[model samples]
Target chain A: MKILKQLKMTCKDTSPLISESMDGHISFGKRLRLKIHLTICKACQCYKNQLEIIKNLAKKIGSEDFSSKKNQTLRPEVKEKIKQSLNNI
Target chain B: MNDRQLDSSMWVDRYGDIMYRYTLLRVKNVDFAEEIVQNTFLAAIQAQANYAGRSAEKSWLFGILKHKIMDHFRSQKRFQSFNQSDSDDSSVDDYDDSGHWKIFPKDWGLDPEKAAENTELAHRLEECMSGLSEKFRQIFIMKEMDGIDSTQICNEFDIKPTNLWVILHRARNQLKLCLEAHWFQNKTSE
Candidate 1:
């Protein structure tokens, strides 16, 4: 019973670390514990998978995409405003 | 034609739109973004003599824009207030006392290829990002979109590395939840 309780606590504690681990390094013990918990916990497994997808998608949809020349352009008037500001400087 | 005057006039045509878009994503306000970009160029003009061509011209302008962005948030006190209110609400609700998810993660129910290819998904993401609180939005974009390093983010925000991780963790959680509800789940239903 105590082992089962500890396992549950391990699963809970390691979930956010799963997300954080993607950005940087995690300790070997924690990584081992996370792996153990993931084997037993389907929900956390799903969470880790989804977090990976989110992270990948975010990397793909970078600031360049939002600022892509074909996607969004400054209004001509705004451009004019900037040009005027520049000339006045 | 002095270097400063020539550079100032040419920058409007060359770097203006790109800087505007970059600032717009961070600031999430068109007018404010425009103003910041304008100031960035003006500051560049004033400091053009100091720009020794060590970096690319575009990078130099971006550096100035970044400082202007920080100034905008700091002067408005947006980050301080929003961090207090939003962090309080999110940090408590997402995880239970035992650090387990109160709500289990939901399957997105879409093929990864299809989801990534969809232009509409990208549009929805920008909308969802805009919905984030100012500080979270700024940090998430700086880290994920702009690809800025964590250490740089910490120095810029005057936060410790641990605080940076906590903010990033919360930001990712909020973004995941937001995209699931508005994009993935909604699209699956439709």
Candidate 2:
């Protein structure tokens, strides 16, 4: 019973660790504790899965080129002038 | 133009559009993004001699562009205040004193592969991101999108690691709630 108590973590204690774990910053002991807690706690597991989805989605959104939607670009004249400056340097 | 100069010109030709896209997403301002990209090229030109040929030219240019973006954010007094004011509203309160969620997370029904192919979802996500407070949006983008290290982000923002984690936690929670309402739940109801 004492051994089980040592591994127990409430969702409040473990939720922030979910974010920290994603960033690869959590300590190994806390990670193990979180993992053990996650195995038993379905709610935190759902939270962990959802955060992973959000992170992956954010990364995709970040890498995407929205130029086609907005049609924003450096004008040719600006590009030409920058190149000219580069040449003069 | 000499070979080195020609190389520099080609760098702009190759990286200008990519950098413009990246900066535009972060700043969400076309003119500012353009100015930053232009300045990145100028800075590259001024520091041309320092190019060690260690990293890819694209990466080196990106390093300069990232600094330029950080400078723009640092100069914005509004962003600093927004950062402070928004802390009270963080998702930290969602958890109870016992450290369990007052309201447990709802299943998101996320399909990452399908979502990746769905341009509409991508656009929706961009909208959601833009909806975030400026500082949260910037830190979230820098960490998740740009793949900047946490320690570097801490130093850049003059924030402690714990503060960074709290901000990131709130950012993720906010984004999840936003996307769940806009994308996931909307899809189900439709």
Candidate 3:
């Protein structure tokens, strides 16, 4: 039982998701170990919250318009010029 | 127009913004970014026969653009600005004061959902992002703002998975603390 417990903590240490503990890609044993750790660890719970915040902020930033009129103006001409230059080679 | 020029048009239409934006972020200069995009296309045209199509067409253009950015940096001796040479070795210590730390990230319990409706907080957050180091800002923009996956980002930046994770973790924590402090400071002042 003691050896099994050490093995569990070692798994948690190596796993990236032990903090935020993302789902989908983790192995069953590792996931169980992380779940056990999270049940006792307030720090890991805070880390999970932080990850959620980052993801939410990222989603908001993605919806905003980062493109400008100048960037839009350059597109067509740059495309035309690329084709023209390619054909000559 | 020549056949090569016509052939290049399809490629350009597909990848122009990607190449331009990638270059713009790396160089941080509009004219230089435009020049790099033009040169990348021109080089792609000349080397059109070499494209293997293994990667997506946009990725190919971006790969070329990356090279062009490097070449431009090399020629102008502004390579110092594009330096990620030291960034790889740098790790977050308990305290690395030489690189400013505005807020200590100790048990803030900051919740984004709570902050979501606050337009003032969003504006302040953007201001803080603008103030981050160029390396940190680019990584944050590419990974977080653009929603690129870690594997794709690793391929694009030529960094290892560990390094990529470090950048993402640090960028997230930094922004969180920054936003919390910004909001807290304003609240106290009010």
Candidate 4:
């Protein structure tokens, strides 16, 4: 049952499937296959999520605002202003 | 157990920095981060009745802050264009010859929330990213960060869909190894 064996998918085969699924490109069959693999594989699951967070954080870097004020804490005036408005509520 | 316990009093003073740190890590803009944090507070005040007070106060506030951040990202997604422009034509081999990882993924033992919170880990990610090839860096960002459609990327890069996935696999794998070496290694030692 070589066909059946291949259907099982390997960490290697499943790796690309993980990335492909993120782009909404993987087929239902492959998606199902990837899900099955992930159930048994912790590492691939870890890879799936780590890439996601990195992607989320990196999205900000790629945005136009990347060049603007970065990593600064809330200003005291803005803090004061928000506090006052909340108090008004 | 009521609205009084959920009072907005001292909210800005108490949760201000915590909210700012979380949003800044996600949005990476000081002004924007401040805006979202402010909105989060406002939203909390509006939804003040929803705080069941079963969860910790900080987490309850954090939950609202996350929703506000996601809403911002979703609205921002409309203008999300890559330099390539979209005709829409479209579009991790972390394994070895036999299709198994040469070495299994070493659990960094950090959950996504914890990993995202670690400022030092974020710096390591930036450094590891810098080490990827220019093409790897570009495609990874285009696919992962830019949220570009896979087929559209294929059309823009003039590469087959299969090749794009291969490139992503390598790029992700490389980042994994680099982070393991830089961040997790130190984490274990500590």
Candidate 5:
């Protein structure tokens, strides 16, 4: 019975779909499994859509370099120091 | 100097700043982030023999920096469970699980593009981040901002793959809800 519940859960959980949808790292098996789940479940579909949006928003944040100002300010001394340290070692 | 040390030094010179920036995004403290970057380079120097040259050196350093970030978080006692009142069922229940999805206009209701365009969204994200529980914040920043792979994150955090997924889901959900409540609700009211 516990195995049956586990099987049911393996059947019920839409994590594979959500994970693939978010990360774009879907495996062939996970893709087929997701198709099977989405064929029957509507909630997972909406969840997947929201997940995509969240993922895209995150991508936008990554594209924008919030650290550019700091990057530009790497003092020549620091660069020289790093170079010297690497040279000495 | 040994060839390994020479090659590692060259790699660090090329990629250290990028790694430092990645760590900074996750750790949110310059000094700590720099320390992690230093450790990542030091570890790379030590482990250069093990590097099979499978991935780009940048990716390899990133992999190490990621571990260092997680170590910093763990040492700071920031590794905590994501406790929420909403059960998993309730959290995901709002949407249909089927593949059919509607891509409605994502107003997020905040017009994050406008916020981002205004140059305040960065700080807004930072402020909103400060409100999160430390674990959620770290996980979100690492996965979302640093573009670290989930499997690598799981290995670093010493968490099961399942636990990593749940933490990521809850963190994203919490961040979305926080942004909506703090920044978007007023837009809707208008």
Candidate 6:
């Protein structure tokens, strides 16, 4: 019955499994079900691939290499205020 | 006073700009980001006793900064935002009643094996990320960008494992649709 349930999973059910698989491990049964669904479903496959792309770019965005070069930092006045406050302590 | 100011100013001189940029990237508000960094420095100074030998001062400062960032997310008004998202599966429309994609995602044509670095794509992705609600954005970045494990995140946020996955899924679905519409179909990257 459980195997039947896994086999009957729709894109709705399987999509989360697809996403969860990336975040961490899903059960072997769920992974098997996802594989079957993905093999048959082009959209689900696309969703999986696109997530990988998004993940790749997101890592760069979070890392210094992508963000630090934008030339943004603390304002001089703000720095002075922080320093003054720190000196008061 | 001179010794303490020297210590404080030295921290500001070295880590202030970097911490500001890091916070700004996540929070996307200059004032709020600066406030968070300022709090981080202040906290680090207070926590200096516990900090010794635990780690490098720079990492200790950044660690405190990360806590401050999470604290901002965990503030009083965050309950409303979290509750709203919990009640609504905003990506429900992305699929139909029968559980199929209402609009099939466009072929991004990226190689699944290799992630080619494209600043333009990164810039576009960052823009799309900002469109997400703050809670979703931070969790997504933590899991995907910061390499934090799902269990740790679940414990940290006090969310059910299911809720965490759902949040991540919604974020991915939304970001995908957004990038497809704004970047792929916009003819800039095409």
DockQ of all candidates, in order?
0.43, 0.56, 0.24, 0.28, 0.16, 0.57
Which 10-residue window in model 3 chain B sums to the lowest lDDT? B94-103
Model 6 spans with C-alpha error above 4 angstroms: A1-9, A68-70, B1-8, B76-81, B84-90, B96-98, B149-152, B155-158, B187-190
Between prediction 1 and prediction 2, the one with superior TM-score is 2
Model 1, which residues run further than 4 Å from truth? A1-11, A68-72, B1-8, B52-56, B77-103, B109-118, B155-161
State how far residue B168 of model 3 sits from its true place (Å). 1.0
Worst 10 contiguous positions by lDDT, candidate 5 chain B = B98-107
lDDT (Cα, 0-100) at A64 in candidate 2: 39
- Residue B143 lDDT in model 5? 83
What is the TM-score (0 to 1) of candidate 5? 0.53
Q: TM-score, each model? A: 0.76, 0.79, 0.51, 0.53, 0.53, 0.82
**What would you estimate as the lDDT of candidate 6?**
0.78
TM-score of chain B of each: 0.71, 0.76, 0.48, 0.51, 0.56, 0.76
| lDDT against the true structure, each candidate | 0.71, 0.78, 0.59, 0.69, 0.59, 0.78
lDDT of 4 at B153: 64
Arranged by TM-score, best first: 6, 2, 1, 5, 4, 3
List the lowest-lDDT window of 10 residues for candidate 6 chain B. B1-10
True contacts kept of each: 0.42, 0.66, 0.26, 0.46, 0.11, 0.64
Share of the reference A-B contacts seen in candidate 2: 0.66
- What is the per-residue lDDT of model 1 for residues B16-130, given as tens digits with 9 covering 90 to 100? 7777777776787778988898788889888988887777777778888888987887676533643444434355565777767788877675555455565666666777777
* Model number with the top DockQ: 6
Ranking by DockQ: 6, 2, 1, 4, 3, 5
Task: Give the docking tier of candidate 6.
Answer: medium
Candidate 3 residue lDDT tens string, B43-148? 7777767876666555566668767876664555433243455344332442334432223334434675764445555555666676677667766766666666
The residue pairs found clashing in candidate 3 are A17-A21, A83-B5, A83-B9, A84-B5, A86-B4, A86-B5, A87-B3, A87-B4, A87-B5
lDDT tens digits by residue: candidate 5, B42-79: 67777878888777666667778767877787787544
Model 1, span A1-89: residue lDDT tens: 88655545444576568867877888876677778888887777877777666665666666443443235557888789877866776
